[model samples]
Target: MKNVVITGTSRGIGLELVKLFAEEDFNILALSRNAEPVSSIELDNVSAFSFDLGTEVDLKKASDFVENEWNGKVDILIHNAGAFLNKPFQETALEEFRRIYEVNVFGLIGLTQQLMPFMDSSSHIVSISSMGGVQGSMKFAGLSAYSSSKAAIITLTELLAEEYKESGPVFNVLALGAVQTEMLAEAFPGLEAPLSAAEMASYIKNFSLTGSKFYNGKLLQVSNSTP
Candidate 1:
């Protein structure tokens, strides 16, 4: 079975991804702030790590655990953890931006760097972005901070793909549309999403495992309609 490392597995798309991979018997290293939810899954293939992306201690512990458990041979690494804020640009405090950036950008880079040693030539690194991050998308009034972070994700993935071009470990970004999840609900209250978390998770599984072969350093936009 292939080994997969996923962050933000406590709920929503991350949780669904964990369930899908666990059912397929893939060895999964699941990182999340809360462990109880993931522990309830009762799958031997799933190992839940209580991790707060904004915390240095948690990142170090997770890195150590991964080093001991999988060595340096991760088949797939998915950076799915993210933070979202839905305040107007002016009202959004600097602290809010810092908090979101810490999780969505800094934390992501830290974990990816820590795990890079384990990734091989055949490995794939997938970063989850947002449609709002894409230029010309329907920009909402209160998504400035969140959208900017996701935009950063796309650029970072592209840079990594080029950096790793000659060696291996393909990199790609998935710019997803609104999915019916807690985060989406929180971001846009009362707005119904066309896609569900389970459906998104399935697509993510297929992409990470196989479909990523079609492209490298590309931002694939996924949504109910063209964004």
Candidate 2:
């Protein structure tokens, strides 16, 4: 079975992705800040652990698990963890802005670096971004820190794909629109999203499995709505 590692598995799209992968019988490492939700499922093919992208110790733990348990082989690595902040740019403190980048950008960089050694050419690295991050896309007020950090990952994905073009492990990013996730609900209360978390997760799962063959260092605008 292919080994997959997913971040932000505690809820929403991340949680749905874990279930989809488990149903497909893939060996999965589900990392989230709260491991209880995933751990309670008790799937033999799934392992749940508390992970913080900003914490070096957590990163080491994930690296060690891949090294010792999966034998240093990861077929898919999904960077889905994100930190959301809905505040006016002027009111957002430096520390708060930095925290957003820490999780959405720096944390992703650190984790990808840590696990890249275990991934081969056949491996796929999918980073989840937002529509707001795309250039000339619809912009939302009070998401300056969040959206800008997401944009960083899109460029980073393209760069990694070029740098490792000969070595393999395809890199791609998905810039998503609004989905009915807790994060979305919290960020924009009372606004109903056109798609559900499970719906989006299914698309992401399918893409992660096959999109690498057709695309690399590319950004797919996976948004049907203008959020």
Candidate 3:
């Protein structure tokens, strides 16, 4: 069985992704700030733990789990946790902006660096980004902090893919448009997204399993509607 580590497994697409993987009997480590939801499921192939990307202790815990339990073999790593701030650029405080970057950018960088050792050439690192982050995509008014931070990860993914191209562990990012997720509702109240969380999760699961064979360091735009 393939060992997979997924962040943000408490809710939204992340939670759904965990369920789909568990159904397939993948050895999964599901990391979320609130572990109860996943833990309550109690699947034998799945392990749930509280993890905060900004915390060194939490990162270390995940690394230790991979090292000790999975024997340092991670077939797939999904960076799905995100921080959203829906406020005017001028109104968004410096700390709030930093918080967004902490989870969406710096935190991702930290986690990838921590787990990179456990990943080999066959491993795949898939990051979830936003369509607003894509250059020349439809820009949003109140997502300055959230969107820009997401853009950072898109570039980071490309850079890592190039750096590790010869060795392995492909890196790719998906720039999603809009999904009917809690984060989306929080960011754009009353807006109906074209896709549901489960629908997007299924797509991500399939891509994580096979996208590496055809693409690396590439950004796939997975949006049907402009947000």
Best by lDDT: 2
The per-residue C-alpha lDDT of model 1 at residue 6 equals 93
Clashes of each: 1, 1, 1
Q: Quote each prediction's TM-score.
A: 0.96, 0.99, 0.99
lDDT of 2: 0.96
**lDDT of candidate 3 over 139-172, digit per residue (tens):** 9799999999999989999999999999989999
How do these models rank on lDDT, best leading?
Answer: 2, 3, 1
> Residue 31 in model 2: shift from native, Å?
0.5
Question: After best superposition, candidate 3 residue 201: deviation in angstroms?
Answer: 0.2
CA-lDDT, candidates in order:
0.88, 0.96, 0.94
Which lDDT value does model 3 have at 116?
95
